[model samples]
Target: MAATYKAPLRDIRFVLHDVLDVSRISRLPGYEDATPDIFDAVLEEAAKMCENELFPLNRPGDEEGCTFENGVVRTPRGFKEAYATFIEGGWTALATHPEYGGQGLPKTLNFVVEEMICSANLAFGMYPGLSAGAYNAIAAHASDELKARYLPKLSDGTWSGTMCLTEPHCGTDLGLIRTKAVPADDGSFRITGTKIFISAGEHDLTENIIHLVLAKLPDAPEGTRGISLFLVPKFIPDANGAPAERNGVACGAIEHKMGIKASATCVLNFDDAVGWMVGKPHRGLQAMFTMMNVARLAVGMQGLGIGEAAYQGAVAYALDRTSGRALTGTKYPDRSADPIVVHPDVRRNLMTMRALNEGARALSYWIGTEIDVSHHHPDPAVRQEADDLVQLMTPIIKAFLTDLGFDNANRGVQIYGGHGYIREHGMEQYVRDARITQLYEGTNGIQAMDLVGRKLSAGMGRLLRRFFHPADAYIAAKKSDPALKELIGPFAKAFQRLQQATAGLAQKAMANPDEAGAAASPYLRMFALVALAFMWAKMAEVATVKIAAGEDVDFHQRKLKTARFFMEQVLPEHLAAFAVAMAGAKTVMAMADDEF
Candidate 1:
């Protein structure tokens, strides 16, 4: 099997520097040290760690997977070592707050590192990924005592974490949870329940595992309002805060999954485990959202990661694998058959992958920097704007990027033809791996619903304003640029369609909520396409100005080409999406109840 991965450092830098200008993030109080030189140095080191330490282990990890026996779960070979190297390099503490012993780098840099890690080994990334989410939840909601005890360990990677939200029967519907937490004598609670699909649930990468669990209190009301968050460690800390007595939270079994096999997905049984409450009682979902929102963004990076890897693999195979000559003529007359790169169809797949990957990277990286801005900006209004942007883009990033991730992975397999179907070239694995991303962090359908139902209407459309205002300004600014007519024209028109769809859906949704539900998916796609169009137009603008200035000519030229592809070929899909979204609920609900 020839599954391969290389961190796209140049593209990452382009997004960080040229597109988003992350120096704006560094201007915030805590991120002053996040200079371009520091970013390059950190990214270069991260690329090395990903390429050398982790990428080689990806195939082997997939092959070996994880093993479970006698209440112990062991990660595949090299994972423990790779993880040691990861934490020893302070990778675990990259974006954590300095109060918790982290270096407290801006999340912009951390997001880039995260993408590289996912590209290298997604399974390996999960171990720390979950821990980071747990850290966020705890930092925001946990008591000072709990934070003092747990935050340092989680930040230092001496311990890892998991978000145990799902059970056998309930996942998205947290209101139906059966997990119960009883008040204990020692001011803690007893968490007794079974949680399934728990990623990194029982991995052996770290000394101790902390589980941020969702369970209902004895006196709590029914439904989601009754839910409470608990911190249940796999090993209870001793008086000195080291792993001591075993906690009742044990891995009953691990799930056999389609992908990310090396990342242990466990069926955990908490047998009256002593745990402490986090946040206010009956406010678990609010606190957990702190984790879920960040996880959603991180999952978007997973999609980007897979897309980049799959695209790279397809490009590699296309360049190496000889096939029929070009339709026009043979460019390489000496060879009996030209490489597949000479073919138009092959170029289409390659171009789609490249254009989407680059555009998505630019968009995601922009939001990543905004995360830093939202948290650290001195001005209240600027912070609010950044936060609004993050909220609005979260679902789009999660759903749109993952959809492309799966699409591009399949495209890789398509490009490989027969070789792709089998395990030999590893294109098949990309498909399998990409599949899970859309399913988790809320299904893309659910994401679309969140966009239409929640984010669309939140703060009286303030979230929508965050995206709409800048887009309005950009289109107005560039619509008249004759040199940019090819790029900006397509983007401006598509963006108009998006605005129309937005208003139409909001009006229809006000009349009947089901109209929103019916149009949610297409509306999200329309919004996403327009968003990407905006990014492409911005990139095209930069490429145009930079090319005219004779700076980084090759990179700018390639950027212009990809931007043109996105604007001309890709952004137009919003028209069809807009058509579908505006048609509205009646036809969709016409066949209901017992038609089947």
Candidate 2:
């Protein structure tokens, strides 16, 4: 059976307009024209492209994968055509600067569209997704000349880009990289190195590929400090800024991956490639972070996207497949057996997937709004606070969302039983594709460590107040309301546990750092749960008021029910997480080095 996709535009609009009130983004200088009508049209058209063009290619893309012949990558059938359609629709420049042939829309809108793309086609989305990150990096850190050279093409989708960071010897440890860069007579550098696991590294979709590579220059310091960022294109441009001659970069080969097979993960070898520095020499890591931070959020969306796709498939299957009758009675008296949707177990799985997907979506969009405020807010204090919140939540979003996305994919497979195991159903492909989101863009473990080790203590825990104060304020405001008591009670309890755990981990980590390391993963999970609970509470508050006004009663009621299910069924896991975090690191460290 072919995989199906609907953009969930209703929920998307609800989260954007009803929950987050994204119109406020228009107050920022560049977003004044981001009216509701424009947002609706953009989303409606994006939905058409994603559902009509991309979703159908997902199964075939995974089945056929990418083909590499003599250093050339051919994306699965329909990929190039779909990509052309995507670019032609002006989707690529949706959130970019107007000066660079872009629409100058808010980044929040870009993220909303991105989620639809990822849901429709995870692998194919990488081509433009990588380009967006690369554009961000150059726009932020590169010189005016470099920006003028690269930004226009990247924004317009005439060309694509890649971030070259990892080598064969070093994955996360950038200090261990052995790539070398040497200065030439005309001020450009000659870059030579082999970068592995480069997504969108080499492809036939574009005329040129701009690679943001990390290499070490002569006389540079040791370790990560020695690394420098270089803008090395596949074909060095002529004076007119068009591909003039072939540079020394070439695709060595592509990886044989477990999933996202349609995305070409290449091993790129730069043999003294002509390149120019992107930022101050030896400050490449900081410069690259301009890309990494956005990339992490994009990866989080990938998780949410795959989970949503899986949930939809599972729900469709559950509604159609028949098995034993319902526990109480026959749901379909006219049929031989009731559909699986009538069963409690099936409902449980579907609801879990649905709740997580929706809650995560709300939380992500809220974060996206924060990102816009961080970048564009008029008040310095407001921007700083929003930045702090983004810093604190990025890891939680990346790790917890991806982890649950994988779990949701599995639940989707479980709901399908044996048919899910077969390739034709496409549930298993979701599982495979979601698996990578947790591993790459800083593994979930690294994200947890960053959360517990750096972000929690940053600014002497002041950054945490970005999340805590709002949550506290919401609980205080809603605690006394009769209709909101159930939601507030659970959320308040989880919030309290989160506070205690935060303080406890701070003390324990101070005494022994391993306690932080040991507790990191569970603590991040707990943090994410509390964050989702907060979003649910906020969403329920809006839904309740709307219900009272007799506006879209069914939608508002379902919102309340989903919030109730999340609070009742899922939020209690914070208790276990809190307990595990408080356990310290002794048991984990006590095991012998080779005991396994």
Candidate 3:
């Protein structure tokens, strides 16, 4: 057996089938046919592909990595063949529209499957993950002719896709991007610029690369308003969707980085490359945002997937590797030493990892279901509510989940102690891989600013209105439940604290501009913990009710214990953040810039 990944099928099923209630999702318009059986089948297939095809390459891929010579980038060995298997398996279009040769599975299911792939091999997973985002942008905003030409091939995985937004001078600040788009005699435009840190920009996995580029039109509005998006391919496809002449797009060089070695992060050069407009000229940022949101959420999943794998590897090692003897008595006297799992501290670390991983799973999938409703719900108001909820939580998902992911990876390494630092042990790799999550996809700092500055004040907190109202009602309802009664006090206090924190930011930022920036990161983290605790409480409540009915007492008991661990260990960090946020800007930015 080649160290297979189990898919966390039980937990995923509990989330999809029980906790989220997929039936309600099926009632939505496009997802009406997303039955339980269909979801299971999708997960099963995804599990096999990730475990068999991708996992085998993870270690070797890290060692071999992507090779570049004279502007040609070659993916790790077996990647092309594995990618072919992935394409043939229809793993690329799980959530795309059926009209575009997709299966149209719910986004929630895709989220589950993605977690597995990233866990098995994040390096390889980036290829399709980026492609999915490109496909979404083109499908949603491209012209009819553009859609007819590209969507089928993308949906079918005949060609891979890339999003080229970051430039050397500008990453988080897109307003400063200098990529220029010049209109030509034909309907197409000539794109000329240098884009850096483009994941999956140029690789041999597919016949051609479809780059969704961000550039500015001449005489257009300044800053972000002037930005326009274009679809530039390595080999410009003919009218019949076949690769024609080679376009002017070239890889200046591929970046050599800390993690995700199998993924080719290239600095792309578009020298008068022919490209077609994706959406309206001035509204290119809008189209790019659609892709960015999808990418952000998916990147959050990368954090989540790596954390899950790290935790599992840690737990397995803890159980099997015996060291110290039991303090009370030898539970395993027959052995030379007691299992590390016997120690309370070991248990605490394991519980922390398990609890955080499970809570994140619930939270991520909950957000995924929200995405489903936002896109599929028949009622516009309901859809808007879902959309607002997704927007509010997306930053949190990207920030908080990734932050904890880094923590868990560190803790996983701590669990192995000395062995963890060694490359072959693989624990350290998870930590290295997880470090990038905080920096990219609009750095965690940027995400927090969006959450506190842009999202909160936008509608006078109307976006959070949908989230807070139901949470308040749910906490009130849970007060009467017996198994969940113990959690009520902490949960209620946390919710109240969240409410106060929201109000405090509104008040402080009104006076000091720096207050929000100072508290932005901590505030987003606190918000994420509170929101995740909220989701865990819901899952705990469901587990309690089910356990009382004598339905899988073991699983429910584990769920309750994990919820307890979260409430005990993870929930209190928010209090420290709240204290910091309450300290105001003087505490953070008081020192002069030259003080250093």
Candidate 4:
């Protein structure tokens, strides 16, 4: 059967309007019109597009993949048409500026729409996804002339974009990159190098492809500081800002990836491509981060989206497929066996998937609201605080969520037994596709390192406080409430463990940086669990108040139940993480080189 998806619209609304109360976004400068109704309408329409249009294409797109010949990529059947409809519907411009022909919606709304698209079709999502990141980079850092030439087309989805950072020689180490940018007499640069693993690098879906490439200038210093960003398009634009003559950039080959087969991951070669600078020279990494940070969050959504799809598949199978009888009694007396969902083990798998998915969705959307405040808020102090939260949470969202997403997809496959291993069942594909999210957009390992090394200690724990204070305040306020003690107790304990671990890691790092490196992965995981516990607590608090008022009693009850399950079952993992992190690097480094 084809992969199925029903956008979790109800939960999305609960998280946004009820839990996060995103209506506060309207108080920001440009989002005054973003009432609940507008958000509902946008989400409903985006859901229709994803469910009706993109979901059906997912299996076929995976099977067909993309075909490349003569340096041209033909997307899977229906992809171009779907993309045309997507752009024509103005979905691409939802969060862009009005001056650039965009609808100028808040990023929070865009986050929901993007999640729906990714859930429906991860491969197809990449085409527009990369463009949005490119649009952000240029809109934020590029000069007026560059933005004028690129932003409108990118914003409107008339053209697509790619960020070319990895080369054959360098993946994460920008200091090792050898791509060269030479100044020409015409005040433009000539870029020449090869970029590998460029997603949406060359495709037939759009008229042009804009590449934001990183290269080194002749007079530049050594390593990363010498690097600069350049805008090199596939087809050079005419005076009217339309594609006219071909640029020197061309696709050399496309990677045969393990998953997301429908998305073209290309190897691009630039032979003295005509390009213009973006931002100040030697500041390319700073500008590119405008895209990378957004892309990291977007990749996190990929994990959540795939997990949602997998959970749906698993739930549907569990309800329909009959297996051994229930331990207590027969759930289906009319049949010989009860559905597999009746089994404790199967229920465990399903609940684990559901708990992780819902918690991640809530955490991500909460962060999305912060993104809006960081960008559009009128107060500088509030904006700075929000930005700090974004910085602190980005790695957690990217690393922790994707790692669990892969696990959830695996659980979906396990829930289906032998049938899931086959292609037609579609559960296996989710596993394959989600695996890449952890690997790309900076490996989860790198994200963990970033969290422990850069974010945790930044500003003498000021960034950490963005998350720590609210969680601390919530626990302190609720600890005395007898009804909420079950939920709050575990969360409070975990939060305390996280604080102690943070301090412990900081002190250990002062003595030996290797201690931080050894502890970073577990430390990040522990931190992520606490952050999610905080989200679950907030959700439980909302559910508790709503239950008291007798509004949506069943929904609120379920929320409380799930929150309890997470606290009792999942949050305890923090103890193991904390213990491992506090172990330091002693045993890990005891073995000599080549001893293994």
| lDDT (tens digit, per residue) of candidate 2 on 78-196 | 98898899899999999999999999988899989989998999999999999999999999999999999899999989889999999999999999998999999999999998999
Q: Write the per-residue lDDT of candidate 4 for residues 1-596, one digit (tens) a residue.
A: 44579999989999999999988998899999888899999999999999999999999999999999998999999999999999999999999999999998999999989889988999999999999999999998989998999999999898999999999978999888999999999989999999999999999899999999999999999999999999999999999999999999999999999899999999999999999999999999999999999999999999999999999999999988998899999989998889999999999899888888899999999999999999988899999999999999999999988998799999999999999999999999999999999998899999999998999889999999999898888888889988888888899999999999998899999899999999999999999889889989989989999999999999889998889889988889899999999998999999999998
Clashing pairs in 3: none
- Provide the lowest-lDDT 10-residue window in model 1: 1-10
Local distance difference test, each candidate: 0.91, 0.93, 0.87, 0.93
Candidate 3 residue lDDT tens string, 1-596? 02224568899899888888877878888776888888888888888888788988888898888999988999989999999999998988788788889999888888889899988999998998888999999988998888888887888888889999899988888989999999999989999999999999989999988999999999779889999999998998777679999999999898889988899999999999999999998889999999999888998998889888888888888888798888898889889998888988888888888888888889899999999999988899989999999999899999888887788889888888888888887888888888888888899999999999899986888898878999899987778877687777687888898899889999989988799999898888888888888878988888988998999999989999888888988799889988887788885787889996
- Which prediction has more favorable TM-score, 1 or 3? 1
Give TM-scores for every candidate, taking all chains together and pairing residue i with residue i: 0.99, 0.99, 0.98, 0.99
Model 2 root-mean-square deviation: 0.8
Candidate 1 lDDT over residue span 475-521, tens digit each: 88888899788887888788788888888888999999999999999
Residue pairs of candidate 1 with colliding backbone atoms = none
